[model samples]
Target: MQYKTVELVIEGKTATLFLNRAESMNAMNIKMIDEITKALKEVAASSVNLLFITGKGRVFSSGGDLKTMLSSTDESMFHPVMDQIKNMIVTLYTMKAVTVSFINGAAAGLGLSLALACDYVKLEKSAKVAMNFINIGLVPDGGGHFFLKKRLGEHKAKQIIWEGKSIPANDALQLGIVDEIYEGDIEEQLTFMKTKMEARPIQAMIASKMIYSTQELQHLVETLNLETMNQLEMRNTEDHREGVAAFLEKRIPHFSGK
Candidate 1:
């Protein structure tokens, strides 16, 4: 399967998915979300033991596509986008492989949510991350609300979501969002982590991920089932189909919310 917004490369036990849209800061448009979900499904079907996600250029992701968001008028148009976002997070959280996010630069909104969904996150020293949904008039649509509340606690999570302030890589480390910080060469750090990860037995890694996800998330099954059903319902909308088609064709999607 070929993808436009994302590049997938599988080597031995490691599969790397790069957000290929540097021009847009790898923003979460409908197409990117579809490609990512497709990629995860592919990885799940393969012999890949570890899944690593990163972005091109300077920014990991800038969150939702502002152009799409601004163009949307009908409130119903928002449901499908939110459904996809939730599905992506839930799918990644329950993946049977060890997932790692390599945050090279800025990650905001749904971008931050995706990174946090991974089992491990590595950040460049200069990287910035924020839950920037409040900057606009929208609430956290993705699993940002769930992941942040779980990791940062309810009070701190509310503060971050409400403030929409960017936290640097070092600060993110202290906040437990980023597991490791790379100062010199990011590729070197990734290579080291890759080697370390590849050394583990694949079954053990998968089992560990399952255990942690089950234990950490009390409503894991219910959340994923609800998200899947909601996503299917959203797909029935004209806006959702248009958004997906426009994304695949590499053009700006015009969503009418019909």
Candidate 2:
């Protein structure tokens, strides 16, 4: 498929997928999610042994499209987008290509989840990341729960998710969230890592990834479905409305238990 929101490049045994909506901070709109899903599928089915995922602009991704959120009135508006996100995340999680994510700047909410889905996650030294769904009275989707628990265990993962605070790159690395924290250009680091992986037994690496990913696939699917259901319910709450209002108006949300 022709992609507008994502750019997919295929080179010898390596593929790079860029989140292309820089003006919007590469927000995960339906088009971006669909494009990513299709691109990942193509990479998985081809000769690509390594995949690099990164954003095109200063920030990795701001999160879901807030403009879309403002116009959404019901589950119909939410379901397809959520499902597309789920598909994209699942594809990235299970793909045969050894995937790497370069977080050049901020990665929040679903963006963080996308980074965490990759086999290796690298962050620029000053970059920050957050599972910030709580800020908007929502929960993390896109297999956020699944990946976090795997990396951080249930207790730490729950604390991170519930706090919804932006974590600095060093803090995130110490917390075991990101694999590496780099000082130089993340693009340069990504290129170096890709070359390193290409020299190794890529198929052997792919086999190991397949085994672990297969074992965890069912849990990830359940998490995605649960996130979808809960997000739809959250959309119906008064607090969600308040949160969106506060965000748009640049004020703190006054969330009352209604």
Candidate 3:
């Protein structure tokens, strides 16, 4: 499908989604958010066994679009953004496909949250990621608070968010935020990971992913209930049917938002 803010390429059993607004550092604006959510919904219904997310330029993402945020008068609009973001993160975690994030460079604020949401994060040695919401007089959104707290513990999470510090790839690795650091060919590394994933049973991989994710949930039943409702709502959309059919027919899915 042709998208204005993103690009989707499916090959074999892997689907790669690229943030295409390199000129803007792949920042998240309303348009970008909508496009990404749409793309993810498509991926969720596909036969793709692995999902890879990366950016087009030197930076993974510079975070939310300041211009768009500043233009919004009513704060209520922000809720939809937050909801979409939460759904995206949850979808990545619970997806039957293995999720990987290639952090080529900077990933700040919401970008950091998006990176963390992936099952595995591979960073370039020079990449820098941070939670900079406090610096901009905004609170953490896009599940930054939740993911950070879960990964880094409450105290460390508070320090990072409140201090608004940039974490280099090395430091992020030491902190267990990044799984691997690469200086050479990322495509080779991705191929290696994909091969390893493909070697495993897809159903087993999905079950393991669910077990790990659900281990931290305070109310697993409630979460599953919510997921069920969300899936039901998605099934009613044209994109859902197109996505499923495309996967079954081995063709590219075209989403029109119906």
Candidate 4:
């Protein structure tokens, strides 16, 4: 199928799903979310054993399209996009491949959440990441809470979410959010990791992934549902309005504890 927001390329036992909307810094809109879910399903049905997810341009994803959300006149348009985000994450997490998110640049908000869902993550040494929903007075959705707790546990996860800080590659590595950070020649890095995984008992690796993911599946579903519900409530708040306004106006947001 022809995909506008994402590109799926399969070669031998390897496949790549690239976030293709460089115009918006690969910001995930509803169309992009829809296409990502479809593209992931295509990969799941394929012969690929090693899967890579990255962005077309510099940024992995600037996160969710706040502009799109801001322009939304009806709340009806909002719910489906959140639903799509949930579906996309679930599909990626449980897919039958050893997945890696090669973040070549900035990954924030929903973008960071996507990376966190993957089995392994490789971030560019110069890249930065943040779970920055708080900047907009919003909660982290797209399974952010679940993934973070799996990695950082609840206390540290809560710290990152509340702080809304942009962490550098080394800092993220120390925080254990990403597996490795490579400097220059991402192609070389990709080739190396692809070869390394393929050399392993690939099916066994996939089996273990499926086993763990299946065990935690119910909790992930609950998190997604809760995120969707809370995020909807956040959108109606005065603080969220101020945050978006402050972001667009290039100023500090005065978030009332509303």
Candidate 5:
């Protein structure tokens, strides 16, 4: 199916979904969320057992469309946006295919969350990442908190989230956030991954992914709802307003606890 914000390319048994909005650094918006969920559902029902998700151009995703959200005057629109994001994350996390994230560039905020939801993540050496929700006076959404703590343990995860630091690809590789960091040609890297997945038992891999997700991600739905509420409250705060203003103005944000 055709999509405005995303592109789905199928080659034989392998499928690649490219985040297509390069102009905005592939920032995810409501329409993109809807398209992604629809595409994931389609792939889940298809014979394609391997799925690759990556971004177009310079960034993997700059996260939620902060510019759009901050500019909107309607509070009513926020809830549905978070809901769409939640549904998209849930769909990706629980999909039957063996999902992999190819992080070609920066992954921050909700972008990090989405990448972490995949079964495997590969990155280029120059790729960048951050869980920077706190920078905007927002809590991590899209299961970011859960995925981080699950991988890095509670103490380290809390430090990264609280500090809102951008991590280099080598650091991320050492931290185990990504499966591998490649310095070679992108096409070669993708070809290698495709071959690797093809060699594995597809059904067994899918079954293992499902079982692990069922046990580890049991609280995802509940957490997503809670994140929605928290983010809504944060959005109405003076600090969030300041953060957005500061971001757009390219200045330091002075957030008060209001």
Candidate 6:
């Protein structure tokens, strides 16, 4: 399928999905979310053994489109968007092929959540990452809370989310948020992944991924649906208004926690 906000390329056993919105730093809006859901469906039905995900241009993704979010009138607007994102997360996590996020730049908010859902993540040495939901007076949706706590444990994950911590790629690698950091071309990493895939049975990998998905991520999908409702409530708060206002105005947010 043709996509306006994303590109899908299938080469042999690997399928690379690129977020194509460089101008907005590949922000995920409703349209982009819809496009991505279609792309994932395509990937799921393909013979691809490895699904390689990346973003175009400087930043991997800036997360949600604030312009879209700020202009939204009520919870009705968020419901479909969140549902698509939630579905995208579950599909990526549970797909037959193994998934990898090649995070070449900043991955903030839901972008970070998306990467966290993947099976593996490799970041460029200069990439930046954060779960800055609290900074915007919102809870982590897209199963961010589940993935983070699963990968980093309860205390560390909650601390990062609450403190709105942004970290460098190397720090992320050390903290296990990213599996590797590379300073060279992405082709080098792709080559490494290809070699690794050739060494093992793809079916075995797929079976293991499916096992983990059913045992672990099934619960996450149910939980995130509930989390989205909580996030919708937070988005209606006075603090959320102030946070978005300060963000757009290029100033510090004076959140009253209301």
Q: How does each model score on lDDT?
A: 0.77, 0.89, 0.77, 0.91, 0.86, 0.87
State TM-scores per candidate.
0.82, 0.97, 0.80, 0.98, 0.95, 0.96
Best by TM-score: 4
lDDT of 4 by residue, 1-258 (tens): 889999998999898889999989999888899999999999988888888998988899999998788877377988888889999999999999999999988999999999888889889999999999999999999999999988899999999999999999999999988888888776787788888887799999999999999999999999999999999899899999899999999999998899
Q: Which model, 2 or 5, shows the larger lDDT?
A: 2
Q: Mind giving the per-residue lDDT tens digits that candidate 5 earns over 165-219?
A: 8999989989977888877766677789899878888899899889988886668
lDDT of 3 by residue, 1-258 (tens): 679999998887799899989999999998898888888888988888799998988788999887676465344675566567666666776677888899988999888888888888889899999887655444566667667776788899888887878999899999977888988776786788788888889778777887887775544334434533443455456665665566457886686765
Counting clashing residue pairs in each candidate, in order, gives 0, 0, 0, 0, 0, 0
Task: Return the candidate ranking by lDDT, descending.
Answer: 4, 2, 6, 5, 1, 3
Residue 190: error of model 4 in Å?
A: 1.6
Residue 93 displacement in candidate 5 (angstroms):
0.7
| Candidate 4: residue 176 lDDT (0-100) | 88
lDDT of 6: 0.87
TM-score of 5: 0.95
Could you give me the TM-score of model 3 versus the true structure? 0.80
Candidate 3, residue 28: lDDT? 94
Which tens-of-lDDT digit does each residue in 114-191 have in candidate 6?
888889888889998999988888988888899888889989999889988789987888887788887878778877
Q: Once model 5 is optimally superposed onto the true structure by TM-score, how far is the C-alpha of residue 186 displaced, in angstroms?
A: 2.4
Error in Å for residue 223 of model 5: 1.4
TM-score of 4: 0.98
Model 1 lDDT per residue over 15-75, tens place: 8889888999999788898888889889888888788888987888988786776565455
* Residue 6 shift from truth in candidate 3, angstroms: 0.8
lDDT of 3 at 89: 66
Candidate 3, superposed: residue stretches over 4 Å from native: 214-258
